[model samples]
Every structure is written in C-alpha cells, then in structure tokens.
Target chain A: MNEMIENLLSHRSIRKFKSKRLNQQQIETIVCSAQHASTSSYMMAYSIIGVTDDSKKERLAEITGQSYVKHNGHFLIFCADLNRVTIKATNDEYENMLDNLENSEHFLVSAIDAALAAQNAAIAAESMGLGICYIGSIRNNIAAVDELFHLPKHVIPLFGMAIGYPAHHPESKPRLPIDAVYFENGYQDHEDALDRFDEKIGNYYAKRSENNRKDTWTDQMKRRFQKTIRMDVTNHVKNKGFNKK
Target chain B: MNEMIENLLSHRSIRKFKSKRLNQQQIETIVCSAQHASTSSYMMAYSIIGVTDDSKKERLAEITGQSYVKHNGHFLIFCADLNRVTIKATNDEYENMLDNLENSEHFLVSAIDAALAAQNAAIAAESMGLGICYIGSIRNNIAAVDELFHLPKHVIPLFGMAIGYPAHHPESKPRLPIDAVYFENGYQDHEDALDRFDEKIGNYYAKRSENNRKDTWTDQMKRRFQKTIRMDVTNHVKNKGFNKK
Candidate 1:
C-alpha cells in the first residue's frame, strides 16, 4: 500500500502525549485542510475551538471525564453551528427566522460538517506524526462544555480531540468482521457472523496486561448498558436550544 | 503545502464522472484504508456496501432525490452497525446477557465510526484521482434504503457516496470565516458575527450567476428547517432495534 494508505491502516488512538506543543502554523495548516472539506450547499456549518489555557483545559478535562484532556499538547472542540447562518441571514435583510436550530436539519448538517473537518484534521495530524485521541466524553457534561467554550445559540459541541506526539504506542484494537457488518444490497441478517467475535475479543483481552480489566467486549458492553451515563444530554441539549421537534 | 494537503484543499464535488471503473485491487485498498480508521473501543460499528449494479444505483438515486445517483460511475453505502457485536455476544456463553447494543452510546459510536471510515474512503478515492459526492438523502428515506440494502436490526444507513473519474470540475465552495466558527477556550458570543456572515454570504452569492437564486445562507437553511425532513430517522432507528436512550 502507498504511504497514505499505510498510515491510515496503522492508525491508533494515542491518549498519552509528549509535552511539546504544536505551533500556530501547524494548527493553521490543519484548519485550512479542514476548511477544504465539502459542505452542503457551500454552507460550512461548523466551528472549532482551540483550547490552550492550562486552567481552561483542566476544566474541560473534568467535564469530559478524560484526565488526559489537560495534558494533551493541543486540544480542540468541534461544534455544529447554525446560529451564524441565521444571524447572517437576518443581517442581510433576508428572511432568516429559525424557530428551532437544535433539532432542525441545520444542527445535523453542522454536526456532520464539523465531524468531516475534524476527521481531516486528524488524518493530517497523523500524517505529520502526531498522535491523537477523540474525547467523546465532552458530552458527559454538555452544558458545562458549552459554557466553558462560550458556545452561541444553535452551536453544540459534537466531539473533542487531543493531539500530540505519542508517548507510547497503543495496540491496534480489533474490529467487527467484514461479513458481520457488510451488507449486500439490503440489510442482511448475519446470524452466524458473531460466532467468531467472542473468540477474537477473548484473545484480545488475553494479550492485555492482567492489571487491566479482563472483560470481553460483550461484558464491557453489557456493563455499559446497565447504567445511565450522562442521561441528561437530551434535556440539556433541548435547554441549549436544540428543537428536537 | 504538501501534495496531500493540496489535494484536500482543492477537493470539489464532481457530479459528472467518466465511465472508467476501478479495479478490484483499488477497491480493496480503499476499503482497507477505511477499516483502519479509529473505532470506538474497537467495536468497528460500521459497514460498507459497494454498489456496482446499475438498477440499484438508479433506485438509490431516486431515494436520495438526486437523479445523478443513477448515473454515477460508482456508489457505496456506509452504515452504522451493532449487529456484529450483538450477534456475537448472544452466542458467547461467557458474554453478558444484557443488551447494550440499542443504547445511545452504541448508536453514537456507530455513527461516528461510519462517518470517519467514509471520510477516509473519500480521501483515499481522491488520492487516486477519483471524484466523490456524499449522498445525505439516504437518510431521507431510511426505510426505503434499509429495504433496498436488506439491512438487519441495529444497522442504519449513515450516508452514501458516489465515486468516479471526473468528467467535469465543479467550483470550490466557500467556507465561513475561521473566527465565525472557531472560538477560543469557550464559545465567544460576538454580536456582529451574524452581520459579517450576511455580508460574506451576500458576497458569495453575488459572485454566482442569477441562476444561483442568490439565496442567503439563512434563507436556504431556514427553508430546510421549516419542516421535518428526516423526522422519521429517530423512530426508524428505534425500529432498527437500537435503544437510542
């Protein structure tokens, strides 16, 4: 495979990072590449927050439940933003009234756009030998994240990513089988596909250090499902101006 | 900028494509690259369906409300899947009995994973000089798409993409100003951000032909938001056996 393909194939999340920081130019290049991503109707309905302050990062780290959030050399929060467009429309004397920005197609587009850009940035960073990890925990405390980031109306933080040189190499985690997930024309029921999943997951856990939990994928998933984690996101998002209706 | 960054920056949606087809090796390489993307906890909660049959593409085109889908040289559907994991867990005697596959975390992870992989595939295709257009309309008629693809429970069509050698070059769409989207530590509420947005959008529309409709950004967004387009997605997803809660 070519270098790009190889890089993509060998990709892994690196939570541990070196203390060295990324320069503004590198950040700019990444952002510029992000801007090059496709937008629906040319409306780039997304924004990114570059978090650099030590104290601020600490607060964000707490909000996300990822302690490493504060230690990463570079931190960014990607957001789906539609308020900007609405505001712009109103200013241009165009009819730009949006009763609900949160639950509208506007939010989904912005979120997806932000995600696309974030993926580009991640790939670019990896190409540059940077290690990165996406912090989904940002949703653990959505309101706090919004407050910390001073997010405007109709802007919601979709995900956070921490970037830096890798301090350690993590194993390439296993993925579901091709047949299990891959469908033909319509969705096929793969009744037997999971037969191999348990074996593979068991082996993966076996290789990990005993100090860590020896739980299989199924076990972990069940444990996760049994409890309510961040159960307030729906209400919180609604309060934050997402009109789910 | 490097060639990779340049390719990313210069990316444009090429609706018109040449009739050339990609070899199987090329397809494998692209899929392999997609599989290499980071998955949440290694669940790899996504699958890709390659569509070479013309009739299916035509149907896909109809579903997406884009006639171009029928004539695209290549088309593929990316799906968010929990079937692989769930099916495996069910058969594994040691695995937990509780079903977590229907939870919000599972749904979100699968969506994000699918999106990341799709983006990687898009980038890989572009690197090989192929043009691609992501089809969001697949979500518009989820049931129709699900039936077309024979999707089982716990699988949702996230998006579709058409790929081929370019027959026509499209314009590079403009992006919102960096500040309009990017914030610092928290979200900065700038009162005039919207006014500036109007001016920039007006500028963009003014540069296009009168056929462009000169629709302000807000006008287009508001039109889309006025009614529910993907209103059934949540219910459809739930019907797919995913407990979004």
Candidate 2:
C-alpha cells in the first residue's frame, strides 16, 4: 500500500499525549487541510473552535469526563453550523430562513460536513506524526458544551478532537469482519460473520497490553444497548435548533 | 507538505467516471481501509452496501437525480447502523433494547462513524488514482433508498459515495475563508470574512473551465436556504426509526 493508505490503515486513537503544543503554523495547515475536504454543494456548513484556555479546557474536560482533554496539545470542537447559511438568508432578506434551517435534511448535511472535515483533520494530523483522539463524550453534557463554546442556534457541536505528540501507542482495536459490515448488491445476513468477529474481539481484549479484559464485543455492546444511552441528546438537539419538525 | 497532506489538500469531487470496474482486490483493500477508521466507543455502528447491478444503479441514479451514479466504477451506500447492536441486545435479552437503539446520541455516533469511514475510503481511492464523489442527494428519496437497499430499522442511509477512475477532473471549489470557519477560544463574528469569500468564490465561478458562471457563494447559499431544501427527511428519518423521543 502507498503511504497515505498505510497511514489511514494504521490509525489508532491516542489518549495519552506529551506536554507539547502544536505550533501556530501546524494548526493553520491542519485546518486548511480540513477546509479542503469536500463539502456538500460547497455549503461547508461547519465550524471548528480551537480551545486553548486552561480554565475552558478544564471545564470541557469535566464535561467529557476525559481529563486528557485539558492536557492535549490542542482541542478542537467541530460543529454542524447552519448559522452561516442563516446569516446569508437573513442578509438576502429570505422569508423562510427559520424553516429552511430547521429541516432534518440540512441537519444531517451539516453534521456530515463537520464529520468529513474532522476526519480530514484527523488524517492530516496523523500524517504529520501527531496522535489524535475523537471525543464523542462531549455529548454527555451537550448543553454545557454549547454554553461553554458560545454556540448559537443552528450550530450544534458534533464532536471534539484532541491532537498532540503521543505519550503512549495503543494497539489498534479489531473491527467487524468484512462480511459483517460490507454487503454485496444488497443487505445480507451477517450472523455468522458477527459470531466470528465476537471470537476475534474477545481474543483482542484479552491480549491487549493495557486495559486488558475478558469481554467479548457482544458483551460490551449488550451492556451498552441494554438501556437508553444519552437520552438527553434529543432535547439537546432540539434546543440547538434542529429536528424541530 | 508530505504526499498525504498534499493529496488531501487537493481533493476535488469527480462527477464523471471512466467505465472500467474496480477489481475484487481493489474493492477489498478499499473496504479494509474504511474499516480502519475510528468509531465511537468501538461500536462500529455502520455498514457499507455496494451496488453494481445496472438496474439497481440506474434506480439509485434516479433517486439521486445524478446520472453519474449509474456510470461510476462502483457505488456504495454508507449506512448508520444500530441494527447490529440491536441484534446483540435482543439476543442477549436486554431490556429497553428498542429505547437504546432509538436514541439521538447513538444516531449521531453511527452517522459520524460512517462518514469517517467513507472519507477514509475516499482518501484511499484517491491514493490509488481513483476518483470519488459523495452523493448526499441519496437523502432526497430516503424511503425509496431504504427499500432499494433492503435496509432495516435503526439503519439509516447516511450518504452514498461513487468511486471510479476519473472521466472528468473538476476544479477544486472555493471554501469559506479560514477565519470564518475556524474560531479561537470561542465563537466570533465572521461577517467580513464571509464578504471576502463571497467575492473570491464569485471569481472562482467566473473562471472555472467547466459550467462556468457568475454566481457568488452567498448567492448560492441564499438561493438554497430560501426554503425547505428536503422537508420529507423528517418523516423519512422517523419512518427509518430515528430521532424519536
């Protein structure tokens, strides 16, 4: 495989980072690489907030329940921002600004746009020899996150990413078997493939150097999905001016 | 910049593709690269459905209103899948399985995971001299798409990506100014940046070789956001069993 594909295939989330900061030039180049990611209709309905204040980082770390948030070289919150388009609509005196921004399709569009850009940033960071971790737990306290970031309506903070020099290199976790996650022509039954993956992951968890455990993938998934996870996000999304229909 | 960053910085969506098909090995390698992308909490809540049948491709093309879907080297629908976890929950006899699978946080997690994987797949394709175009228009007719792909509940079609050898190379579209999209510490006003970007994009449209026009970014966004762009997506999402409170 080529270097780009090799870099992509070897991706591992880094939770421990050295006490060093990315220079301003590096941050700018990374963000520029993010901007180059394809946007739907060139809408670029996303914004990234770089948090460097220690107090603010501490607060965000508390929100995510991940202490590393404060110590990472940099923390960036990626948001699905319809506000830019809203601004244009208002500036042009469009009558359906609210209605247009409130649609579920646009919500999905912005979220996907943010995600696509964030992934680009992640890959770029990796290519530059920086380790990165995506903090989806930011949603654990979405309201506080929004308030902390001063996010306006039509701008939902989707996720946060932490980039820094690696202090630890963890083994890449196993994924579902190809058959289980890839269907040919149409969706197919993958129970057999899932069964195989469960065995493989069970072995992986047991063999990993850190956080070793005897948990199968199915066991963890069952534990997670046995009850509601983050039920507050519905209200949070609505309060952030989305899914209003 | 290294080759990877340079490749990322120069991404342009390829709408027209050569008629050649990707070999089995190429498809497997690309899918494996996609599987390597990061997932939230290791919940690999996504699936890719590859469509190669001409009839199915034609139907999908009609749904997207983009004829290139039929002619692309390969087409894959990236789905935000909670069904796998739901199956584990059901088989494990976990209470509240339905409620857990229906939450908005999991919905966002699965969609982001799928997008990350798709972007990796796109980058991998680009690395191999293949071209990619993301088809967000798949949402234009979600129910039909679900039916076409035999998708189940809790498995929404997030987006489709068409990959193939390039038949036409388009110029990279202009993005919002860096200041407008990247904030420091907290959100800031970007009116001046947007105005400058509008002028720059106006020039971009006027100078591009193919389908050249005099439209500004603001003009396009204003036209798009004037009314509901895809109002049916709400019902479609709900019918696919998501965003329910």
Candidate 3:
C-alpha cells in the first residue's frame, strides 16, 4: 500500500496516552484539514471545539466516563452545527429555510459533515505519528454535553476525539469480512458471512497481546445491542430542533 | 503542512473524470482504508456497494440527476447499514436488539460510520492521485436507488462517491472562517464570522477558473435553505426502519 493508504489502514483507537500536548500548530492543522472537507451544499455545518481548560476537560471526562477525555494530549468535540448557517441566512421570513434546517436530511448532512471532517483529522493526526481515539461515549449524555459546550439549537455534539502520543499500542481490531461489508451492484445478505469472521475475531480476542479474552464478535454484538442504549438521544436531538418532520 | 495534511487540506470535489477506472489494487487500498476506520462499538454498521454494471450506474445517475454518477472511473455507494449486524446477532428472542437497531442513535452511528469510511476512502484515493466527488443527491429519490441496489432494510444509501483520474482539478472552495468552525472549550456563533468569509468566497466565485459567478457564501446558503429540498428523506428513512425512537 502507498504511505497514505498505509496510514489510513493502520488506525487503532488509543485509549491511553503519554502526557504530551498537541501544540497549537498541530491542532490548527487538524482543524484546517477538517474545515476543508466536502460539505453538503457548502453548508459547512459542523464545528470543532478544542477543549483545553482543565475543569472543562475534567467535566467532560466525567460525562464520558473516560479519564482520557481529560488526560489526552488534545480533546476535541465535533458538533453537527447548523446554527452558523441560520445566522448567515439572516432571513427568518423564509419559513422554508427554518423548516429545512430542522429536516432530518440536514441532520444527516451535518452529522456526516462532522464525521468526514473528523476522519480527516484522525488521518492527519496519525500521519504525524500521533495516536487517536474516537470518544462516542460522549453521546451517552448528549444533553449534558450540550450544556457543557453551551451548544445552540440545531448544533448537536456528535462525538469527541482524544489524541495524544501512544502510551499503549493495541492490536488493530478485526472488521467484518470484505464480502460482508462490500457488495457489487446490490446488497447481499450476511447470514452466512459471520461464522468465519466470528472465529477469526474469537482468535483475535483470545490471542492478542493485551486484554486477551475468548469471545466471538457475534457474542459481543449480542451483548451490545441487547439493550436500547442512548434512546434518549432521539428526544434530545429533537428538542434541539433537529429531525422535526 | 505535511504531505498527508497537505493532501487532506487540498481536497476538491472533482466532477469531471478522465474516464480512467481505478485499478484493482487502488480500489482495494481505498476499501481497506475505509474498513479500518473506527466504528462505534465495533458495530461496523456500514456497507459499500461498488456498481460496476453500466446499466445500474445509469439508473443511479438518473436517480441522482447527476450525469457524472454514471461516467466516473469507479462508483461507490456508502451505506449506513445495520442489516448485517442483525443477521449476526441472530436471536429472534432479542427484542431489544431489534429495537436498538431502529433507534435514532443507531441511525446516527451507522451514518457516521459510513462517513468515516468514505473520508478514509477519499483520502486514500486522493493520495493515489485519484479524484472523488460526493453525491449526496442520491437521497433525492432514495427509494428508487434502494430499488436499484436491492438494499435490505436498515441499509440506507447515505451517499455516493465518484472516483477517477481527474479531467480537471478545480480550485479548493473556501470554507467558513476558522473562528466560525473551531472554538475553544465551547460552541460559538458565526454572526460576525461570515462577513470576511463572504468576501473571500465571493472573490473565489468571481475569479475561479471554472463556473465563475458573483455570489457570497451567505447568499448561497440563503438560496439553498429557502427551499426544503429532499424532504421525502425523512419518511423514506423511516420506511427503511431507521430513526424509530
């Protein structure tokens, strides 16, 4: 693989990090790269908040239940923000604009915008030899996060990123088989595809260098989705004036 | 900027391709990079459909109303798919699993997964000198695209990407001011941030080599949101068993 592709493929979520801050230049580069991502209709409907204050980071750490939130070299929250666009549009007389802003499609657009930007930041950070982890746990308490960030309506804090020098190098987690995730011309059923992958991942969990355990991917997934996690996000997002049909 | 950061920042949506299909190795590299992106809870809730059939591409082009969709070097539909996970989780007795899959948070998760994957693919493709453009207009008639792709439920077609050797390199479109998108510790407003960017983008639109026009970013956004475009996506996504609280 080429160097860039190699960098993309070598991604791992680093939970532990050495005590080194990502300097201003590095953080700026990350945000700059994020800003350049392809936005839907040039809406640019996302914002990156780089949290540097110790108290705020500590509060975020408590909210996410991940100490790395406070201790990471850098903690950045990616919010799907359309409030900026509303400000620019400057015409409240246009009811369609207001309604459209609340459309689920815009919701999709903004969230995708954040994700695309974040992945660029992730790749950019990694290319510079920094380790990173996506803190989706931030969504576990989205309302509190919004309160912490003072997020405006139509600006949902989607997720956070924790970046730093690696204190540990965990083996790359296995993904679903190529056929299972890739199809040609049409989507295919994965009813049979998981058996081999389950075994492969079971082996991975059993023999990996750290935190080795014996569990199949399916079992983990079953344990995961067996409960309705983050169901409150629906009402929270709606209360934020998004996904209103 | 480092080479990769330079690559990330220099991204432009390439609408015209040289009619060169991405080679197998390049395609594999792109897909590999996508698969390696961080997924929420290892759910890997996404799929990529590579449409190689000319007729299928033509149909998708029709659905998207973008002729470039059919003429690209390679066409990829990045889908927010949880159908595979449902198959793997396999126990019909698990009501919560079924409920969780339909949760709006899962909708967010799957879509973010797809976006993260696509961004990696975009970076990988660009690094290899291939160009790409995101085709979110596929959601214009998502039901038709779903019909064409034979997608299962919970496999929403999030967006399409057209990849190829560039026939033309468009100048990078200007983004919002850094202060507008990046904040310190909290979400911020763009009330004043747009004035400078409006001038910058207005200049870009007036002076650009291709499709030059006279307009500011504010005007474009106002024109964009004034019409409630793709409003059917909400019901379509609901029909596809997503965003169900």
Sort candidate 1 into its docking category: acceptable
TM-score, chain B only, every model? 0.92, 0.96, 0.96
Which residue runs of candidate 1 sit more than 4 Å off their true CA positions? A89-106, A191-193, A208-219, B90-105, B190-215, B241-245
Weakest ten-residue segment in model 1 chain A by summed lDDT: A88-97
Best model per DockQ: 3
Docking class of 3: high
| Docking quality tier of model 2 | high
Q: CA shift at B238, candidate 1, in angstroms? A: 3.5
C-alpha lDDT score of every prediction, in listed order: 0.73, 0.87, 0.87
DockQ of 2: 0.80
| True lDDT of residue B208, candidate 3 | 88
DockQ scores of the candidates: 0.46, 0.80, 0.82
Local error of candidate 3 at B107, Å? 0.3
Report, to 2 decimal places, the DockQ of model 1: 0.46
Counting clashing residue pairs in each candidate, in order, gives 16, 0, 0
* Candidate 3, superposed: residue stretches over 4 Å from native: none
Residue-level lDDT of model 2, residues B42-120, one tens digit each, is 8888999999888999998898899888998899999999888766556446447766666677778888999999999
